[model samples]
Target chain A: MKLKQLFKLVLINIYHNKMRTFLTTLGVIVGTATIFLVVAIGKGGEAQVNEQYSKLNVGTIIIMPAQRGKVIDPLTKKDAELFQKSKNIAAAFPILNGSGDIKYNNYSDKSSYLGIMPQYQEASNLNLLGGRFLTEEDEKKKARNAVVGFELANVLTDGSPEDILEKTIDINRRKFEVVGVLKRMGDSGSRQSVDDSAFIPYSSAERYLLGTRANPVINAQATGLETVKGAIQDITNILNENHRLGGAEQFRIMDAGSRLASAQETARTMSLLLLSVAVVVLVVSGIGIMNVMFVTVKERTKEIGTLKAIGAKKKEILGQFLAESVVISLVGGILGVILGFANLPVLKYFQLPALPSLSGVLLGLFFSVTTGIFFGFYPAWQAAELNPIDALRYE
Target chain B: MGKESKCIIDARNIVKIYQNGAEELKVLDDVSVKVMKNDFIAILGPSGSGKSTLMNVLGCLDLPTSGQYFLDGIDILTAKEDQLAEIRNKKIGFVFQKFNLLPRLNAVQNVMLPLLYRGVEEEEAVRIAKEKLKMLGLGDRLNHRPNELSGGQQQRVAIARAIVGNPPLILADEPTGNLDSKSSMEAIKIFKELNQARNTIVLITHDTEVAEQMKRVVYIKDGRLFQN
Candidate 1:
């Protein structure tokens, strides 16, 4: 028979009973739609993380200090200078974190501050709203000048950005000049929220604020993103050589790339888990298709018999039923994929990272069609194997 | 009439037995018959008389338990399933009492089915189906479904379908059994007209009146054949 005629015959049968076909296809639709949504959202999440990489500086690495037995990790000025000397390393600085009560007239607030070199501004993507950032001269002379955060500015003057500039506030019982007020970076809270903190010269924190031996964290920047791992390697070797505490390397180095990689891996695992659940649903739906097809065969026994009497071979009957099953799933798959992408715009309105991918659509189509063929075969075979004489005799 | 009178179906000692648990029910016991081209023959039998069984054997729908049966010179009893299907497609057309039309297809589409099954192109199949339907006086009802047609019209449509592919033989089972007297006569008139075109036809029924209309008559009683 001509392929087109076969298709027409199959379509006629399907159209003759619309409700049964639609109900059978619904299971596949739900399963494939869920798959589409999950993959799109996963891709969107990865895109979002990549977008944040620009602000977070993917090449930057931080060496945190903690007591590893009798000795603590030392991020000294000399160590920073040695780190900067490396060919792959761009700039390195020491971070001295301390909290002190700062008093401005009648209002006094306890605030956290990071003592750093002048390189903190560019490395942190800090927006200086007013006044100059602390210069090298401030660190050299141990000047008591501070870079106030946006939140601290609100705490100090109860006014705009300009009100907090050039204002002096007492820190740890010593007077300090507010040299800069940073603009608020609201969404980058995960990147060590700089809004509520302050920055001061490292020399002032080491000499006056923390008179005791303060173990500071070392922050290093790679010249470019490609050199990050190399920069980390060179810095680790240099730090181990400098610390010289026997065989134990005293510092732990972490980078945005590693964190991002682990985050991506977790997302992938979650998406796969969700996709597996959807696959299970699809399998159930495939079974549902099988059941419906079996019932359809039973209902159409006389028709099959008539077709045979009119010269249809067993395989032709099988092909017709199988085509019906495939058409059901294919239609459901297309609709499910559309439904998956359809939810994306709504999700995006709520700030969800959701994107439709070509691979995801193709996979959905492949899976649905495979499910159709796999589940539809046995029932169609059963129909084909029926003795035409008996089928015709069936009431 | 030499070429037109060639044998269309020849069956000898065709025995078909059905197994019911340990009991063997002989549905067709040693039945034998020969039908020639342009022969308008009827097989008359009451319920359980094995006339349907005989029809099945002649139509190549079932293989005899043991016997030789040939349709249009092909040995159907020895033919494989697919070969039987091809032979049936090329040599035989069937009309059922129920009109057996696919309810979703209109009259023209249903009539075009056999030609379509024969791999005829769509336009050619439609043309042939239309010509046959017009001859059967269903030209105005080409797009009407089976349910939309009256009993006689539906039977006419079935006749049109059976002859549309130009198969040499038409095997009809109780063709007018569901119709009123007038529709039954109309359907019988169609059978006579088709037989006039030199197409061999075998009609199965329990009605002696319907049997009398055919040019020849055969009877099945208790799975055995008697001819006149």
Candidate 2:
């Protein structure tokens, strides 16, 4: 039989039984939609991770005291100074993390602050929107100056960056000049959002805000991407010798690449889990298709017999039934792609990241069609193999 | 018929048995029959007399347990299933008691089925089907589905479908069983007309009245055959 005519026959049958066709393809629709959405969300997560990491210097590494037994000398300013002189390390600074209530005129809000040296600006890839960042003179003189984050500057003063810069803000009852307003970089990969924090000289933070009792972490930048390993090695040796640690490791070293890797791994794991769920749904939907095809063949037994008597070969019979199933799934797949696209706005409403991709849509369609073929074959074969005598005799 | 008249159906010592596990029930026993070209014959039997089984075997729908059967000079016993399908497509037209029109298809589409299966172009099939339906007094009902037609109209449509391909033989099993008396007479008239037009026909039924109208009658009783 001509394929087009055969398809028309299948279509006529499917069209007449609208409810059955809709119900049979429902599972496939949901399955493929899920597949598409899962892929989009996975891509969104990867893009998010990449964007976060891209905001920071690639050679930046964080060294913190690996909390085990206390009383081992914590990383100090002297240790940071030693790292700055090391051949592999290009720049190093001790970071003192603290939160304080800031008062700018009548507006007051609690914000976290990072205390670091002037070199920390380049190491952290901080971009200024107005004025200049902290200088060597400011660190050496222990001047009370702060470079506010984009959001912090908005909160402390007028929304304008130029207005926020050079404005004085009260931090823990001490006045500090806002020398610069940093550009917005959103949430960092390794820490809290940089947009909500302020940067100040480490000398002033140690002497005035956080006292000598607070432990400080050292942030360092390698001379080049290739020197990161050597930089980490130099940091460990310096901290071990300076702190007088014998055999046990005291500090934990983390590089930007490793952090990016772990984030990517998390994204990949989530994608795999969702893909499995989509597969399960597809399998269950496939079984549904198989079940419906069986019922259809049974119900059309006399019709099958009639067609056989009229000269339809077994393969023609098989093709008609199989094509019916494939068309059902193909329709479902197309609807699923539309549904997936439709869900993008809902995800956005919930503030979830999702990036629609062509590959995801293709994969979803491929899965649905494969499911149809895999589950549709046996039932079609059964219809083709039916005895014409019994079939025609069937009530 | 003359000695030169070719046999359309020639069966010798045909036997059909139905097996249920270890128990076996014989449906046909040593039944032999011959049908010459353009012959009109009826095999008459009551229920359980295996008349339907004989129709099935003769239609090449089921294989006999032991038999040498030839359909239009082609060996039915040795022909493969696909070969039987092809032969049935090109040589046999079947009209059933139920009419058996596919409900989803319109009259024309249903009538075009055999030709479609024979790989006829759809346009040609449709055109031929329309002409056949017109000749069968179904011209106004070309697009009507089976349910939309009366039993007689549905039967006419089935006859149109059966003869649309102009096959050599028409096998009808209780073709008038589902029709009213008036429709049954009309169906019988059409079959006689077809037979007179040089198309071979074998009608299976238990109704003596229906069988009496045929040119030849064969009686089947409890899997055995007798002719008068």
Candidate 3:
């Protein structure tokens, strides 16, 4: 039979049994929709992580002490100086962080305090939203000056930083003038509030706050992130040499870039797992279509016999049934794409995270159509192979 | 019929056996018949006399158990199932007692079914179907479905479907069995017209009146051919 006639026949058959066709196509629709939704969730999670990662300096690396059960790094000034003089290391600064109370004339509040070097601003990509950052001269002169975080500055003073730059605040029973206030970094990849902190010169912190404490934890930045591994290795070797461990492990080094890469790899694996599950659902849906087609062939036995007696070839009969199945699945798949795309805003409304990609939609459609063809073939073949004599004799 | 004339159908020493469980029951035995082009013949038989079984074999719908059956010089008993079906489609047409019109299709579409299966163009197929229906006196009922038409009109539609493809041989298996006498006579009148128009027809019927309407009659009793 001509393809057009076959198409018309399929349409007429479906139209004759609208409810059955709709129910059969519903399985395919739900399967496809589930796949698209799962993939969107995975994509959404990855995109969220990437957006968070983009806010920081890509070339910066965090070096935390890796000693067992020890949260603080115990490096001395000599070690910090050695790292600052290493090749390809533009700048390095030791950071000694602690929580303390800041008292400013009945406006006392508790916040984190960090003792950082002058170059810490350049290394950490810290933007100062108020006054200037710590200076090398302030460190050399051991000036009791401090730069407050944006939130800390607001809590300590009633007006802007200019109105409170010369104000003195007592820390550990010592009075320090806030010469400058650092800007709020908003939130870090660690998801902690960085705006509620105070910055002071590293030397003064070592002399007064820490009381001759050894080198604290430090953060450094590289000119190029591609060389971050090499930079970390270089820093590790220098620290080992300076600590007199005779090339043995003395200080631990950690690379944030490598950590981020590992996180992304984990996300990719999760996405793949989700997609595989979706494919399984689609395969099951295909089997359902095949089963329904078989039932349809049995129901239309007389019809098949009539067409065969009228000169329709086996291939023509097969094409007619296959066309019916394919039309059902393809139509279901198209509606699935629409449903999947429509789910994006719904997810956004619930704030559940969903990234609907065009590639995912196309992939779902391709699978649904292929499922129809693959599953429809066997039933169609069975219908075509039916003997006209037996079929006509069948009630 | 003269030996020189082409016999549209010739069956000799035909036999058909049905296997039910272990016992083999013979349905037809040593049946022989000949029909020439344009001859209107009737096979008269009672129930279970194998008239319908013989019709199935002659229509290329079933293979005889052991026999020689030829249709238009082709060995129908030896032809493949698909080939037999093609011969039936292109050279023979059938009108069943129940009319057997697809309930979903209207009169015109019902008549166009065989041509559509033969891959005829839609416009030409529709034109021929309309013309045949008109000729069958169903012109005004072209858009009516089977349920909407009267018993006689439905049979006329079936007859139109049978002859629209212009097949040389037409088979009617109790074509008037379901109709009233008046309607049956009307259907017979159409069959007479088709026969006079040079269309060979083989009609199976038990009604003496129906058989008398044909030019010749062959009788079958207990699966064996007999003289009427």
Candidate 4:
């Protein structure tokens, strides 16, 4: 039979039972919508992380003290010395971290203070706006030199990076000379901005503030991208040897690449799990299509006999039923794509990533259509194999 | 009738048996009949007389359990189910007692169905269907659906569909069964007119008067056929 005629017949049947077609297609719609929406969210989050990490160095690795309840000694001068001597390591800075209220003349606010050596200004990619950074002699004599981030400069000097230099700031009730101000990066309108942080000499911080603190972290730099893996091995081996650790778990070398890779893997597994749930919903929807088709065949028994008697072959009848299901799925899938795309705004409003692409639309349609065909087969076959005589006799 | 006329329907010792769970019923017992082109005949029987079963076999909607049957000289007893459909499309047209006009399709579209199944172009099928409906005095009702037409008009629409393709044989099961007496006579008159136009028609009915009006009547009773 001609495809046009078959389509016409299928159209008439669908028109005859509008509600059944809609009801059968609803499950697929929900499944497609859920899957596409979740994937978009996952993509958006990954994009956000990538944008944030782009400014920093990929060769930078952050090593914090272990949380294994063994009182893993804080990274100290001795540890920094070991790092400077380690192979594949170009620079190392032991970060003494503290958070306290700072008073600069009449301006006072809470700030994060990171104490490091003068090499940390270059090794940690700290871009300064003006003035000199902390020097090695300052750390030896324990001079209270301070460098403020853009957020701190804005608070203390009314947003002028240069005005904050040569000023005095009291940190945790101790006076410090403002030596420099860090450049602005990822600080505007974000709570997790590094621009709000303060920096002082590591020896000075250990002498007067945050003495014998636990969970101290160290920031290490590799020579270049090429020696990153070797640098990581050296850090792990050197830290293990200096701290007399037996296991590799005492200090982790969390590099930019490994961090991003782990985040991506976690997102992938989470989205896949959600997608599987959507697939399960789609499978149930497929069963719904099959059940509806079975009922449709039974209800149209006399109509099937009429068609067969009027010269329609078995295959033609089968084609008509199968086409009906495919049409249902196609409509549902299109609606699902629209629904998912429309929900992207809601995802974005919540600060989530919404990366709904054209490929996602195509995949949604493909899955829905395949589901229709695969589940509609047995019912279509049953319609084709029906005995015309018995069908005609059915009341 | 001898070989002077071309035989369109020939059944020799046709048998049809239905299998119940524990019992087998013989629906058509050695039924045999012969029909030629332009023949207007009726298979007259009471309820349970196996006339419908014989109609199914002769219509090629079924195969005989044990017998030789030929439709338009194609040995249907050996034909595959799909092949029977091909023969039915080209050689046979069927009209049911219920009129069986697809309620969704209007008059012209209903008559175009048989041709459409044969892959006829849409425009040509519609043109041919329109002409046939016009011939049946349904020119103004071409766009009227089955539900919009009266019982007689629906039956006429069904008759138009059956003969629109100009098949060699038309098998109608109680074509006037749902019509009033006046509509019944009108339907029978149309059949007579079709016969005059060289259309072979087989009417199945229990009405004796309907049987008497036909050129020949084959009476079926107790799963057997008797020529009358």
Candidate 5:
């Protein structure tokens, strides 16, 4: 028989028994839809991770005092300068982090501050809202020049970037000139959030505001992503040599590469777990299809006999039942694709990320159809192997 | 030579045995029969007489335990299952007692089954089926499902289905068993007209009146055949 005619016959049979077909296909629909949704959610999580880490360079490494050790020798400007001389290291800077009160005329606000080198602006991806960043000349001359963050500028001057530019603010008890206001950068999976902090030259911070009370760390950049490990090794050699503590390491280095890798691994593991769930659902639904197909064969025993008596071969009868199951799953798969996409807006409304991929839809369809074929074969075979005399005589 | 050449069915010493663990029931015991082309014959038997088993063997639906049976010169015992199906498709037509019309299909589609199985194009099959149904006086009820049609109409549709493929032989099992007297008479008249048109037919029934109407009658009792 022509394939089209066979499908038409199968369709007519399915159409006449609408309730049974729908009930049999419901499990497939849910399974396919679950697969699609899982892929979309997985894609969304990957996108979110990429976006969160977008501002931080992968080669950037943070060096700090290890929490487990009491440091007799702290990271200093001289240590940073020595590390910058290495071939693998692109740039290195010493940073002193401290909290203090700032006074601008009568308005006062408190925030954490970072005393950093001139390269910190570029390395940290801090964009100046107005005016200019602290230059090498300011650092060399120990000029009390400060750069305030966006929110800090608003709190101090209650004005725009132009009004906050060049305003002198008192840090602790020393007067400092604000050279620039930084643009806003929201918090993410980074070592520090600089949104409301203040930046100043290290010389001025140590001399005027935080003398002898500073906690300093070194931040280093590698020339390329692949060179980060070499740069870390070089920095470790330089620091251990300078400290001269007989091989007892007192510092810890955290690289953005490991952080990014861990985050991506988390996302992949979550996707895999959900994918397993989808597979379980598909397998269960496949068993449901098998059960239903067996019942269908039993119910249509006389019909099979009648078809045989009218000269339908075993292959033709098998093809008919198999095509019926495949068509049912195909229909369910298409409906599932639509259902998955339709839930995208709902996911967005609930603040969940979803990115429906074409590959996801194709996989869903492939799995559902394969399930139909795999589960549908046994029952169709049973129908084909039925003896015509016995079937016709069956009540 | 001409008489042997015209034989459509030639069965000799056919035996069919059913086994139930240690017990064996011989359903057909040393039965033999022959049917010629264009010959109208009836195998008449009461219940448990095994006429249905004989019909099953004659129609190539069930193989005899031991026999040399030939239909249209094709060896029924030697043929494979698929070959028998193909032979049935090309050389035999069947009408069942219950009219056996698929309840979901309309009259025309039901009649189109045999032709469709012959790999005839759907349009040609439908055209032949419509001609057959129209000849059977179901011209206006082409779209009616079996449930919507009366018993006589359904049987007429079944008859149309049986002859649509223009097979050499028609094997009907109790074709009038579920019909009323008026419908049964009409069915017999249609069979007579079919035989007059040179179509061979073999009907199985218990009704003596129906068997008397045939050109030849064979009685089956206790799994044995007797011709009168």
Candidate 6:
């Protein structure tokens, strides 16, 4: 028979029993939807991690003093000078981190403190919500000024950045002037609480906070990510020469780029794991389709016999059943894609994060059609192989 | 008939055996018959008398265990299943007792099925099917499904389907078995008209009255043919 006539027959057959067709396609719908949702969620996590990683300067290397064995201490001015003298090191900043109690009028709270050189703001990529960041002149003059985080300033004074400027805050019994306020960084899994910290000049921190400590932790910036390893080696050699340490027993260097890479790798592994689970669901659903098709073949035996008696070729019979299976799966796949796409806006309406993309929809369609072809073949073949006499004899 | 005239079917020593465990039961034993073109012939018998088996073999629906059966001078007993289907499509049309019209198709669509199977274009198939239905006095029932039509109207639709492809031979197995007397007479009149119009037909029936309506009658008993 011509394919057009065969298609018309299949359509009429399916239309004759609409409820059974829909129920049989439901398995494909659920399977495809699961695949799309899982892929979208995986992409969502990847985007989140990539966004967090982008916040840091790529190829930046952090150098600090080694303590006990391999632990690094906060950066100090002496270490910064030693790194600056090295050839491969492009830029360096001495950093000191500590938690101290601050009191402004009757509002007293404990907040994180970061003491760093003026160049640290440029290297750290900090966004300023109000006032200005610390200047080079301010660092050179050993100015006892600080930049307050947005949340920290809110806790300290009941005013804006203009109102809180030059306000005195007692940090460990030493008073410092607030120069600027940093912007609000959104909440994520990263451990750094940029919202609750105060920034100060490194020189003043060394005088007041470091006391008799020899070396402080440092944040070093490289020209590019490719040069970060070389910069770390250069800084390590300089630090060893300055501190008079022996070979292989001196200081440790931490690369923020490597940490970001490991974080991305973990995210990729998790996404793959979730996708595997979704694949299992798709396979089980394919098996369900095969089972339903087998039942359909059994139920339609008399119909097949009648068709054969009317001079339909075996291939024509096979084509009809295969067309029915494909129609069921394709319809289900389309519905699943729509459902998956619709989920994004619904999630956004509820303020929940969701990622839906074209690739996910394509994957769902590919798997659904493949499942149809895979599961629809055997039953169609069996129907085609049916003996006309026996099938006609069947009640 | 002249020697140049075609004999639509010719069979010799046709035998069919069914295996039940170790015992083989014969369904058709050494039956030989010939049907000429445009002749209306009927095979009459009671239940289990092997008439249906003879019809099946004549319709090319089953191959005899041992026999030489020729349809349109082609040895159908040696033909493949697909080839047999092709021959059935091009040479024979069948009408079943149960009005085996597809419930989903309208009268016109069901009539168009054989032509469509023969690879006729849709427009031509529809035109031919409409002409056949109109000839069968079913012009008003073209769009009605099988369940929507009366018993006689449905049988007329089945007749239209059988004759629409213009196959040389028509096989009707108890064509009026499910209809009332009036409807059965109407079906029989249509069959007589078709046979008079030069269409070869084979009718299988247990009713002697139905068998007498045909020009020639053959009786079978206990899987063997009886000369009458």
Number of the predicted model whose lDDT against the real structure is largest: 2
The residue-by-residue lDDT of candidate 5 on A1-395, one tens digit each, is: 78888988999998987888888888788889888988898898888788777888888888888863466777788988988998988999999888879888888888788898999889888887888999999999999899988888878887764587787888887888889888887765545568678889999888887787666888899899989999999988988788887332778888988988888898889889988888888888888888988988998899899889889999999999998888888888888888888888998999676889998899999999999999999999999999999899887
Q: Rate the local accuracy (lDDT) of all candidates.
A: 0.85, 0.90, 0.81, 0.85, 0.88, 0.82
True contacts kept of each: 0.69, 0.95, 0.51, 0.73, 0.67, 0.56
DockQ metric for all predictions: 0.61, 0.82, 0.49, 0.68, 0.70, 0.59
lDDT of 3 by residue, B1-228 (tens): 565377988889999998999999888999989989989999999989999898888888788999898888888866776677688789888888878777777899889989988889989999999999999888899999899999999999989988989997899999999999899989999999999898999999988889987999999888999856
lDDT of 6 at A270: 70
Best by DockQ: 2
By DockQ: ranked, best first: 2, 5, 4, 1, 6, 3
lDDT of 4 by residue, A143-164 (tens): 9899888888898776566787
- Candidates by lDDT, descending order: 2, 5, 1, 4, 6, 3
Superposed on all Cα atoms, model 6 deviates from the true structure by an RMSD in Å of 4.7
Per-residue accuracy of model 1 over A1-395 as CA lDDT, tens digit each: 77778888889888888888888889899888888888787888787777666678777888876453344545677888888998999999988888878777666778887888888778988888888888899999999999988877887776664686788888878888898888876656264567877788999988888866666878899998899989988887887787776322566788888978887887788788989988998999999999999999998898888788777888889999999999999988998898887888898899777878998898888889999999999999999899888988877
Q: Is candidate 4 or candidate 5 better by DockQ?
A: 5
Clashing pairs in 5: none
Query: Please, what are the lDDT tens digits per residue for candidate 2 over residues A172-264?
Result: 888999898899877775456678888889998888898865578888888888999999888888876787654217778888878888888
lDDT by residue (tens digit), candidate 4, B1-228: 665389999999998999998899999999989999889999999989999999988999888899999888889988888888888888888989998878788899889999998889989999999999999899999999999999999999999889878899999998888899999999999999999998899999999999889999989999999997
How big is the positional error of residue B185 in model 4, measured in Å on the Cα after superposition? 2.1
> What does candidate 1's lDDT look like per residue over B102-196, in tens digits?
77899999888877767789999999999999999988999999899998999899888888888888999999989999999989998898888
In candidate 1, clashing pairs total: 0
Better of 4 and 6 by TM-score: 4
Candidate 6 deviant stretches above 4 angstroms: A49-55, A62-89, A96-114, A125-133, A144-199, A203-217, A222-254, A345-354, B1-4
User: How much is the lDDT of residue B211 in candidate 2?
Assistant: 99
How many residue pairs in model 4 have overlapping backbones?
1
